[model samples]
Target chain A: MSAKSVQMVLYPDTHLDQAAETIHRLRQHGIDDRDISVISGVPYSDKILGRPMSWTRIGLIGLAGAVVGFAIATSLNFGTPYLYPIRVGGQPFFPIPTSIVVTFELTMLGLLISTFLGVFIETITPSYGPKGYSPKVSDGHIGVLFSCPTEKMDEVKKGLEDLKPEWVKNPEAKL
Target chain B: MAAETKTLSATHSASQEGEDLRQEHLMHDPKPREEMNGMVMEAMQTTSKKYWIALAIFGLGVLILLFGFWGNQIITGMGVTGKRRPVFWALYITTFVFWIGISHAGTFVSAILRVFKAEFRRPFTRAAELMTTFGLAAGALFPLIHLGRVWTFYWMIPYPNARWLWPNFRSPLVWDFLAITTYLLSSTIYLYLPLIPDLAMARDRSTGWRHSIYKLLALNWRGTEAEWHRLRKAINIFAFAIIPVMFSVHTIVSWDFAVSQTVGWHSTIFGPYFIIGAILSGVSAVVMILFIIQSTMKNMKYFIRLEVFDSLGKLVLIFSMAWAYFFFNEYLLHWYGGYQAVRDLLTFHAQGPTAWVWYTMLICNVAIPWLTLWNRKIRRTPLAMFIITTLVNVGMFAERYTIIPLTLGEQRFPFDWGAYSPRLTDISIVIGTFCLFIFLYLLASRLIPLIPVWEVQEGQMAHSTRKLGKGKVTSVAELE
Candidate 1:
C-alpha cells in the first residue's frame, strides 16, 4: 500500500474463475499478495479466488468474554444469595441450578457482544477517512488494487489490460 | 448390461429433472447486481398512498393508545389491568410471551439458514431481522406496563442503590431482564452488521438526505479484502452465537413461569415447548409479512416468490406438529397426575368461559396447518399462505393466553379462584403495541433497503445449473 497503488481493474462480471485468473496474472507480474487488495460488494473469501486466507480473532475474543462473563455471573450468583439470605422455609442457600441459568445467560451475552465489537475493532469502522476506495465496488465490480515501483507501472497496466476489465482508475484514498 | 443399467437409472426419480431451478429459486434467477440494487432502491422509494394511509392510521392509534392508556395505567397503578388475586399476570404477560415467540422466527430463520448455506434465505432475512427487533421492542414494553411504579424502571439496572440493594440473581425476573437486554443488543447488532454492505450500496447511487444518511451508516465501507474477511468472520460468529442467545432469551422467559410453584407452570418441558411455539409463530409472522411486502411493495415479486412461501409453509407445518406434540406431552403428564386443582385448570381451559379460545387455538395452530400445509398447492399460493399464517398467529396468541390468563384465573385453593379479563386500558395498551409494531416496520421499510442485495448477488454467483445424466439440476458452489 505504501508504494502508491492504483485500482488496476473493475470487472463487470462475477465469474469466480475469471477473477482468480486476474489475480494469477497480477502475481505473474510480480505483485505480492500483501500488495494486492480485493474489493467487491459481496464478502467473498480470499481462498475462493486463490488468494491467501486472512485470519480473524473474533472467535477467540468471544471465548475470552465468555470466560469473563462466567466468572462475574458465578461471583454474583454465589455471593449475592448468601448476602441477601432471605429464609425460604426449606429452599437451599445457593441454588446451583438456578445459578447455572444466570451464568449461562451472562456467558452467552459476553460471547455475542464481544464478537460484535470485535468486528468494529478488526475493521476499524466509523473510519470515514481517505484510503483506497471505489464506489463501483458496491455496484458489484471486483476492483483489483495493487502498488508497484514506478518503473513497473507500465508492465502492471499491460497485465491488467489483458484481463479485459470494464474500467480502470486510480483509487482515491479512503482512509 | 447397458440395457439393465438404463432400466435401473430410469427407476431413479429426478423431481427437478425438467424444471428450471433458476426459475424456481431466487438464487438461480438473479438479475445483474446493478438491476438488483435498482429494484431494492425502487421498493424503498416507491411508497404508495395506501402505505401512508395505513401509516397515518397506525400512527394515530399509537398516539391515542400508547399515551392515553399508559398514562391511565401510570395514574391508576397496577389495578387497571385484570391482575387480580391469583391471576396476577394476565394479558400483558401473555402478549409479552407472544411477542417473544414472534421474535424467535427471525434469528431462527436468518442465523440457522445462513449456517446451512440456504440460498433462499438471502432476500427475506432482513424482513425477519426487523421482526425480531420490533417484536422485542413490543415485548419489552409489557414489563414496563406491568410495573407498579413505571418510572422506577431503572431499579432493574443493577446500579448500587441508597440502601445498597442490587438486582437479585436468584429472581427469574432478573434473569429475564438480563436475557432480554442481551437478546435486544445482539439482534440489533446482528441486523446492522450485514446491513453495512447494503448501506454502502445505497450510498453509491443516492443524493440529498438519503445519500448523507447512507454515507454515515455505510461506515466508509469500500469492501476492502481485510474488511470483508473480518465481516465474514464476524457474521459467522454472529450466526452461531446468536442462535444460542435466541434460545436462551425465550427459555429464560419460560423459566419466569416454569420455576414457579404453580400447578401447570412447573414443568420441565416448558423450555423446549415455549421455544418450539415461538419459532412456529415467528415463522408464520415472517410468511405473513413476506406476502404483504410481495403483494404491496414494488419489485418485491423478484425477491419474494412462491418458493419462499413454500419453504416457509413447510417450516410452519413442521413446527405446528412440534407444538402439538409438546402440548400433548404437557397435557398427558398433568392428566395422568390427576391432581384435582390441575384437573380444574385443564377443565377451565377447555370448558370454562374462555374455552372457545382454547378450542380456537387447537383449530388455528394445529388443525388448520396440519390439514392444509401438507398440500404443495396451498403452501405455494401467497394468499393461501397469508391466510394460514395469519391463523397460525391467532392460534399462537390464543396459546399464550391459555397459558397465562386462563391458568392465572384458576386457583388451587378453589375459594380464591377468579376469572380474569382485561380492562379497557389493558386492551388499549395491547392494541397500541400492535399498532406501534406495524408503524415501526412501515417506517423502516422506507429507511433501510429490505433486500440484502450483496448477499443475493453472492448467492447468484454461487448458484448455477449443471447438466446431469438426464437433466439439468441446481448446483451451488461454496464461494466461501
Candidate 2:
C-alpha cells in the first residue's frame, strides 16, 4: 500500500448515534469492512461499533483449557498409585466423586487464565512505544481508523470529513 | 493578585451563608487530581507509632494463639479445641462457613451488577473483590487447621502411596476444597483484569518504585482501540461466566454439610439455605465497607451515595427473607420428619449451652433486616444501615457456629457427643485474618484505583437528563 493510502484517522463525537452514523458512512464507501476499526475509552460491542461479527475463539480456547485441566486433575487423582499407594476411609482406590471437585477447580482455573490470555492474543495488547494513538480518545472520544487506496485518499477523507468529524488526519505514526 | 483574591473571598462568604451543604459529601468537595492522589498516598505512607503499636499487639496475638496455642493443641492432641469424638468438626468448620459466606458479597457486587450495568457498583467493585480474596484466604485456613496434624494436608488430594489412601470423593469436605480453590482463582483473575487499566493510570501519575510497580502491573497498557476491544470482549465473557462459578462455590460449600447423613446436616434444603445466608451476610459486609470508604477516603462520598445504600438495603431485605424461608423450610422438614437425631439437634440448638447465640442469630439475621430495612428512611440512613448490616454478619456467623459444633453436640451415641470450645490460638488466628484483610485493603486502596474511573465515566455517558411535560427525569440508554 502507498504511504498516503495505508491509513486514516477520524475523530467522532462521543455520542453513540453519531458514531454509528460515521460507521454507516464508511461502509457506504468501497472500504473493505475488515479494514475499519473503532476505538473508545469504554468497551462497546461489535453491533455498537457498526462492524460485522467478530469470530473470537475465546469460548473455544476456554473449552480447550478446561479439557487440559480435567485431564491433569484426573491423572493426579488416579495415577499416583503405581508409584505409591495410600488408602484412606476405606472407600475406594480411585474415587470419582472427590475427583470431580479437583476437575471442576482445574477446569475453571484453566478457563479463566486462558480467557485472559486469549484477550491478549486476540488484541495484541500491552503495546508500548510510539503508535497511532491519542490520549483524548480515552477522555470520551470515538476514533475510527480505516484504510484505502492512495488515489482515493482525498475522496475518502472528504467523504469522512463531510460527516463533520472533529478532526480528520492522515497516517501520523504506525502502531 | 491580592485584589483578585480579596474579591474571590468576598464572593465566597456571600455565597456560603447557608449550612455549607458541600461538606455533606466527600465527592462534591472535589479536590484537584494531584491533591487527591497526595491524600491517598499520605494515607498509605503515614503509619504512626499508634498504628505500629496496634500491629505489634496483633502480631503478638498471632504468635500466642497460632503458634503457641496450636503447638499446645497439637502436643495435647486436638483436646484444646472442644472437638470430641462425635463432633470432630467444631469451631474451625464454623469459622470456615462464616468466612466463606463473607466472601460472597464481592462477587455479587462486582460480577452480577457489572453484567447488568449498575452504575453504583462502579466505585466499590475492587473493594468488594478484596473482600472476596481476603475472606477466602482466611476461610481456606480453617480446613487445614482442622485437619489437626496440619502437616498431612496433602492426604486430602488424591494419590496412591504405600498407604493406598485416596480421599473419599463422596465427602463434602473434599468437594469444598475444590470449589473454594476454583472460586479463589477465578475471583482473583476477575479482580486483576479490570485493575489493569487503573494500574496504568496509577503508573502515569506515579514516581520512583511506585511507578515501576504500577508499570510492571500495567503491562504496557496504552489503551489502544484493539486493546479496549479485546478487554471489553474478555470482560463481558467473564461477567457472564463468573456468576455461575460464584453460585457453584457456595452451593458446594453447602453440600459439604448437606451431603452428610447426620441429622441437621442431611437436609436437601441446605444447599439453597447456605447460598441465601451467604448473600445476606455478603451484602451486609459490602454495605459496611462502603460506609467506611465513603466516610474515610477522599473523593469517595460523591461516588457512593445514599442511592447505593438504598439499593443494598433493599437487597439485604430480600435476601433476609429468602434466608428466613430457607431456614423455615429446613426446620419444618426436619421437624415433620420426626427423626430422633434431627429433632434432638434442633432442640439442642434451641435450648442447649449456645441457646443465647441461637436466638440472637435469628433476631439479627432475620428480624432486624426484615423489620427496619423495609422503611426507606432507615435504609437510606448510613448509621442505621451500618448497625443493621453488622448485626446481620454477627447473626450469620452464629448460624454457622450452631450448625457446625452445637448440632454436633447431639449425636446418636451419647458417649461420643461433646461441646466445642476454641483454644486461645483459634481466637488469635481469626483476629490475624481480620487484620490481614484490613491491611491488604488499606494497601490496595492507595495503590489501586478502588473506583474504576473508566466504568464510572461509561455509566455517566449512558445517563442523562430528559424533560417531560412538567419535570426532568433521569434516563439511561443501552450503550452496548
Candidate 3:
C-alpha cells in the first residue's frame, strides 16, 4: 500500500534568493513540482524562482465573456429595435455608428466582469474552511508548502531545516 | 599618488549623491514588508478627534445638502431650479461632467501608470482607484437629480418590460447610461482585485468584527503562487483594457453635447477636448488628494514622498498644455470657420456678463500651471501642488460651466436668447455631492488599506543604485 501524504511548511524570509535555493533543494528530493506551492506577501515571477509557469484560464474566460457581451449588445441594438420599431427620420432600424457604442461598452463590460469572475473561479476563492496556511506568509515571509509520503516527512524536514527557515513543520500543526 | 587620491574623492562624492537619491525616492527606500503592513494597518485603525469632527461635518453635509435638497427637489419638482427652455441642461449637467472628469483621475494614475511601468505610482494607486469608484458614485447621482420625475429614471434601462418599449440606443443619454455603468463596474472590479491581498494582510492581523469583514472581503486569499499569478495576469489585462474604456466614457459624455443641434455644442473636437480636460482635472485632483493623505494619514510620509508629487506635477503640466492646445484648437476652428451663431457664442463667452468664468478657466488651467509648474521647486512642494491642483479643478468647473449653461444661454435668434443662473436648490445639491464624495473617501480611508504595500515592497526590491561613470544613477529591474 502507498504511504499516506503529509504536507510540510518551510518559512523563508521575503528574499527570492533564499526561496529559490529552498525550492531547488525540494526538487532535488523526490518531490514533484506539482506538490509544491509558494505563499508570499509580494508576487515573484516564476522564472526568478526557477518554477514552471502557473497556468490560468482567465484570459480565455475574459475573451469568452467579451463574445457574450458582444452578442447581448447586438441583440439590444439590432434585435430589440425590430421588437418595437420607433422610426426616427429615415435612419436605419440599426445604425452601425450608434450600435458601435453599445457593442463596445457591453463587450468590455463582459471582458472585465468575466475576468474578475475568472479570479474567483481559478482560485476557488471565498473558501473559509481550514487549509494549510500561515499568517506569517502575509508578513513578507515566503512559505513553501509541499506534500511528501508520511515516512519521508522527517527526511524532507531535515533537508529544509539545513537552509535555516523561520519554521518547518506540518502546516496544520498547532503553534 | 595625487591622481589616485582625487579619483577616491570623486567616487566618495558620487556614492554620497546616490545615497541622497535613495533617501528622496520611495522605490529606493526599502522597508520590511511586515513593518509596511503594520504601518498601513495602524493608519487605518488610528483616527484622531479631528478626523471624527471632519467626518461629522461631511456626514452632515451629505445628509442636509445632498439628501435634504434632493428630497426637497423631488417633492417640489424641477421648477425649483433654473431650467428654462433654451437653458434646460445647466449646473446639474456641469457638475455631472465635472464629477465624471474627476473619476478619470483614478484610471489615469492607476491603469495608465501601471501600463507605462511608471514606478512612482506604487504607493498611492489604491487612493486614486478609490477616487474613481467614489467619483463615479457621485457623478451617477446627477442624472437622477436632473430628472424631473427621478423615479422614472429606470426608463433608460435596456430591458424587456411591461410597456415592451426598449430604450433608443441612438440617444447619447442612453449611451451615457451604458458607458458610465460599464466604467463604474470595471473600475470597481479593478480596485477590488488588487485590494484582495491587502484585505488578506488585514485579515491575518485583526480579530473580532474587523477580522470577520476582512476575511470575507479577502475571499480567503492564501497568497499562493497560483493566486498571485492569476491576479497579476488579471491586473495586466485590466490595465490595458481599461484605458480605452476610460477614453470612451468621457467621449460619450462629450457626445451628449456634440450630437446636439446647438451651434456651439456641435464640434468634433469636443471628444478629445473633453478627454484632455478630464485627464487634466483628474490628475490634479489626485495630487490634491495625495497631499491630504500625506498630511493626515499616519506613516504616509514614507509612502507618499516628494518624488510622487514631483512626477505627478510634471504630468499635470503636460496635461495642462494638452488641454490648452485642445481649448485653443476648438476656439480657433470656430473663429476661423466664421459661422454666425458660433461667432456670436464665442464673442459672448469672451465679452459677456459671465466672461469671468471663461477668464477663470484660462487663468487657473493655463496661466497658473504654465507659470508655476515649470519650476522644479514648486512641483516638489506639496503645499504648492495642493494649491495649484485645487485651482485647476476650480478652472475645470469653470470650463464645464462655460460649456453647459453659458453656451445654452446663447441662442441663434436674439428673441429666444436668455440668461440662466443656478437657484438655491442647484447650488445646495452641487455642494451636497461634493460633501458626499469627501464623506465616502473619509469612510474608506479608515476601512481599507489606502496604500498597496506589496507593490511598494516589490518596487523597492527591483530598485538599486548603479555606478555608470563618476556619478551613480538609479536603476530599476523589470520584475514582471
Say which candidate scores most in TM-score. 3
Query: True contacts preserved, each candidate?
Result: 0.71, 0.37, 0.78
Report, for every candidate in turn, its global Cα lDDT versus the true structure: 0.85, 0.73, 0.90
Q: Please tell me which model should have the higher TM-score, number 2 or number 3.
A: 3
In candidate 3, what are the lDDT values of residues B135-155, reduced to their tens digit? 999999999999879999989
* TM-score: model 1 vs. ground truth: 0.94
Report the lDDT tens digits of candidate 2 across residue range B130-173. Answer: 88988898788788777889888887775544766556555677
Q: Measured by TM-score, how close is model 3 to the native structure?
A: 0.97
In model 1 chain A, the worst 10-residue window by lDDT is A122-131
**Model 1 C-alpha lDDT per residue in residues A1-175, reported as the tens digit of each score:** 3355455567775555667787888789887877777777887777777888777788898888889888878878776555556667778877888788888888888887888778777666443222476777777688776666677877777776756775455576542
TM-score, every prediction: 0.94, 0.82, 0.97
**Backbone Cα, N, C clashes tallied per candidate:** 8, 17, 0
Arrange candidates, best TM-score first: 3, 1, 2
> Candidate 3 — which residues are off by over 4 angstroms?
A4-14, A125-131, A173-175, B1-15
TM-score of each model's chain B: 0.95, 0.88, 0.98
Error of 2 at B209 (Å): 2.1
Report lDDT (Cα) of residue B303, candidate 2. 67
